[model samples]
Target: MASSMLKSAGEIQNLIFSQNQKLTHLARCGRIDEAVKLFESMPARNAVSWNCMISGLAKNGRVADARHLFDRMASKNLISWNTMIAGYSHNNRVLEASQLFDEMPKRDSYSWTLMISCYSRNGELERARWLFDSMPGVKTPVCYNAMIAGYAKNGMFQDAIVLLTEMPVSARNMVSWNSVLAGYTQNQEMVQGLKFFGEMQEKDVVSWNLMVEGFLQVGDLESAWSFFRATPCPNVASWVTMLNGFSKSGNIDEARRLFDEMPERNLVAWNAMISGYVQFLQIEEAYRLFGEMSERNSVTWTTMINGYIRIGKLEKARELLDSMPFKNVVAQTAMLTGYVQCMRMEEAVELFEKISTKDDFCWNAMISGYAHCGRMDKAVELYKRMPTKSLFSLNTIIAGHAQQGEMHKALEVFKQMRERNTVTWNSIISGLTQNGFYCDSIKHFVLLRNEGRKPDPCTYACGLAACAYLAALQVGKQLHLLLVKSGHVNDLFAGNALINMYARCGRISSAKQAFDEMASVDLISWNTLITGYALNGFGRETISLFKEMEVNGFRPDDITFVGVLSACSHAGLIDEGLKYFDSMSRDHSVERVAEHYACVVDLLGRAGRLEEAYKLVTEMPIKVNAGVWGALLGACRMHGNPDIAKFAAEKLFVIEPQKTSNYVLLSNVHADARRWEDVDRVRSLLKEIGIQKQPGCSWIDIKKKVCSFVSDDPMQPGATEVGFVLEMLCAHIRNTEIMPWSSLLDCG
Candidate 1:
């Protein structure tokens, strides 16, 4: 019996030895599941075998399985307990890790440090600090480093600095210094980061890399280059950072130079260069780079798609998107965003539907596209169908409703928001102003400030525009003061709005002052100031501003030329107007739309060159609209040319038959020519069409409230007194030697 037992024991020992070897090999090779299976099938197990299996499962992120095996173990050593605790820590199950740690019969430095790292990784810095303070044994440098890094990562600069200063002399390390410096750099405090870096006793490669990244963040290529040259040995990240800095600064040439100079190019470096080309609108160059890449990722594919979309090459974007090996939400959304940008709402919707897993961004894009195309009803419908609603989704719905002048609907959406943001407030304020509820727009802006939501640039711009439309100069100035106090007066958007408001209020000097004070000027700034001058009848200032704009390296856009031509026409600069109109397509490459043609025709017709105006209209390349004919008819009235009036009136009857001005202008032209029969016929036609000329009215601002007056108006509060005063003034003028014209007297 003893001999049989000995033989079985020998066989079992051999089997156990072979299985242990196989399990170790599988775990090392990262075949963790196979290792676990091998472990489960074993008939006999030792302490080493159980520890190996538990460690393998924990290392492979199967923490639950590791814990199950641990609980089932009849006996466990300190290593087994530590392994289970570390597994929970690594998996971010901090509570379970802490519980296991408390129950441990013995504790190690590694066990405590793992728990600290776990808390830090999860952004629970306070909990991490408590564990560090209560640790029974000596604190490890690694544990201190983890806590400091967590503070820096969370932007707790003061707390991180406090810890760094209070740490034991031995705990101070390169990682501790780097974490704080990186915190400043990450927070966009590059200047402060530089000051801190200057005081560092010893700097490593990571320190140098961070300084380079900091300079690059602010687009300071010169500073970045100086730092790059100072780097002991630049890594791929350093090279990519420099490349990206140049790309964003619009220096494509410099970016390419850096790309070619890289000793070893990786996927990231290639992507940075490709994205640079995409940003600069060099689409063909981006495509070439994309094709040259040996490896491509999801970002690369999406970037190429975005490049095509920028240049209106939808076909190319579609082709590449279809051929992509994998399609993620980002790639799909890129195509969807392109459709929205191009105002192809239906196509955007179709693409949106094809995305099987639609996220909030995808839904927002479709909703915004519908709103942009003035399909608010469709936008609202899509908003309802959204399975989930984020703040952005709700804001989109409110903006769409606001954009279409549905104030009540916009308000309804605004009230529905459980957590209202500044964007929501801006949408309602801007919407009210756009829909001609200027007073309401300003009122909401005031309410926004009172509600503890400080206004952003959009809010200021919209409010200023409301003031401008209402000609409430006092209110505009008050908002301007608020903008100044807020330190956003120099922002391009707010500055542009200020200029527009001043200009629309006939305060040309104030508009020019705003324009002059701008630290940086964009196309909108120049256009706003010039348009303001033209609007207030400062024709010479508009022309002078245009010249200054050209001299200052500013190119005129379509709107700029519109302002220029309108100014020339208003000032009766016929030759100048014609010269600019001709040069629009030739010199500026600005194609003349119908509006420009109208300006040129008004100029010639107003200058008594009816024949020239008529010839220009007849020879215009584009289809002539009602404005062109209306100009000719107005000129006929001034010159008493009945022949041209009939021609213009006939076209107006077809193009804009319901327009009251066309009928009025034609009747005046016939009256000037003493063509009574034609006048009667035109007046009868107006009556048959049921077109009544709306009474001309003017508004005056009285202590912020607008008081309106119409010709022959009896709606004035003190009409009888006003009539008596007006009669006395007219009688006094007539009593003097200077007598009024017979036609003017009869009309009065």
Candidate 2:
């Protein structure tokens, strides 16, 4: 009986060992479900079986399941604890990993190293360093490597180098040297990377590849080529890197030569070559290579499909996608994006609906498409249907609604967002500014600042624009100070906004100062400052700036000519105005628009040349608009020319019949000429049309508050005090003038 029992025990022990080995192999192969089934059905399991299952689960991104299994383990060992910590680390669950590490009954170098690497990978470098220093035993090379890599990854080159130097010679390996080199290359510090590369006594293919890639990234093609030739033994990756470099630098022929000369070609090399051709819009060459490939993967197919889509060959892209043996979300999304770009929303939606596994990028692309096409309803519908609303989608919805003039909807979305970024604030602020909600835009900007969100350049530009429109000089100045402190004052867009704000606030000198302070200038900058000077009645300065703009090689656009002509009109420089106007199309190729014509008419009218102004109005090539006729009528009233005024008034009535200003100007002109009948006729026509003259309104910014006044309104706060002060001023002026009061009247 004892011999029989011994035989059964031996068989059972062999079975358990065989089962553990099989379970480990299955887990390593990623057959997690099969491994789980096998584990459960095993007559008995040991620690190895349990640990293998847990490791496989965590590696496969089933961290929660692994943790559950771990908690239920009958007996936990050091390997079990270390595996669980590694699981949390792999999934970026740093808090859980730290907690579990603290609960460990025992720890080893592997356990400590896992925790340190976890922190390092998750950008918690300080915690990583602390853990490294606190490690109980001798630090292993792996631990030292983790810390050094962490420093280098975070762009702390000095720290990484110092740590590397402090490492014992036994611990210092090729990885330590390469980690620093990789850091320099990744950070685009190739100059330093090259110097470091020369100092290394040992170099590998990885080191060589890194140098080649670094040169390519910075567009130094010659250096990349030189490095490529010097590499003693270039691998497939090395060849592909050089090929991609040539392709990206617009040297397609060289890429082809290198591709053909490669000693061994892999699928990766072929794909790289095709991607390079596709990137440069060489679709035919990419397709030809695709045909030559004996085997192709999803990446190969997707690259070809995207190449077709990029060149607007949507049908070809669709055909390739359909022919794909297996479809992925990437190719589907690329096709959808192609449709969106072409405004073929129906097809895009058709494809979008067929995608069973939509990623965030795919969903965001669809939403952005609908939003860009002004289909907000569909965009909102799709956004609501998303399983996970990403920040990008939220920003897109807000921008779409704001662009469509649906501020109420935009605000509703904005209010619902629990988290916001700079883009979110910028969309709302700029949208409000664009739609004429200047005050509301400024309020949101202030709210953004109060929320402790750092505003970007776009935010400041929008805020400055609101200040310009409100003539809020104090607020503008405050924003200017903030910009300088933030070190974004030199940004082109912000600089232009500052110039405009100072100009509109009647600070012409300040506007000029802002203009001069700009480190670099675009055409918009020149146009802005020139228009500012013209509006401030600095006609000579405006013309001088325009001349300087041309001398600086900026061919004036239509806007530039408008400012020049307006300056001439305001300064009564008729000859210069006519000369510039003629040179517009001939010298600058700027087509004359109605605003240009209006400026010229105003120029002649202000000079008392009503006939010449009227002739220009009738003979202009383009169809005349209300502005032209209004300019003529204003000039007629000034010179008391009733006949021409009546003609201009009749045209204005036809073009802008609801405008009360035209009637008022015509009535004044008739009264000036003593044409009582005509004046009554104009007034009667205005009344018949049911048009009411809009009240003249002006506002002043006092102590950061905008105070508004309306014509003939006396109910405003401080109105009585303002009238009293004006009366006293008039009395004092009349009584105490050294010269006669008649001279004052003449001057006025």
User: Which stretches of candidate 2 lie above 4 Å from their native place?
Assistant: 1-327, 449-452, 471-492, 495-521, 529-555, 608-663, 674-691, 694-711, 715-718, 721-748
Q: Each prediction's TM-score against the native?
A: 0.70, 0.65
Instruction: Give the per-residue lDDT digits (tens) of candidate 2, residues 596-639.
Output: 99999999999999999999998999999988988899899889
Clash counts per candidate, in order, are 0, 0
lDDT of 1 by residue, 1-748 (tens): 8886564777888888889888887765555757877898899988778888887777655667788899988899888887788777766667788898888998888878877878887778888889888887778788788888878877788898899888998889999899989988876678888998999888988888898888877556799889988888888888888888888977899989999999889988998999999999999999999988998876899899999999999988989999987666678889999989999877887888888656667888888888888888888788889765667878888888887778899998788787778898889888999899998888888778778677888899999999899887777877887788776776789999999999998899999998899877899999999888878777888888999999999999889988998899888777777888888889989888888888888888888888988898889889998878887888888888999889988998999877888888888889888899999999999999898888888788989999777778787787788689979989997777542122221212
lDDT (CA) for every model shown? 0.84, 0.88
Stretches of candidate 1 exceeding 4 Å from the true structure: 1-234, 339-351, 481-490, 695-711, 715-748
* Cα displacement (Å) at residue 740, model 2: 43
lDDT score, candidate 1:
0.84
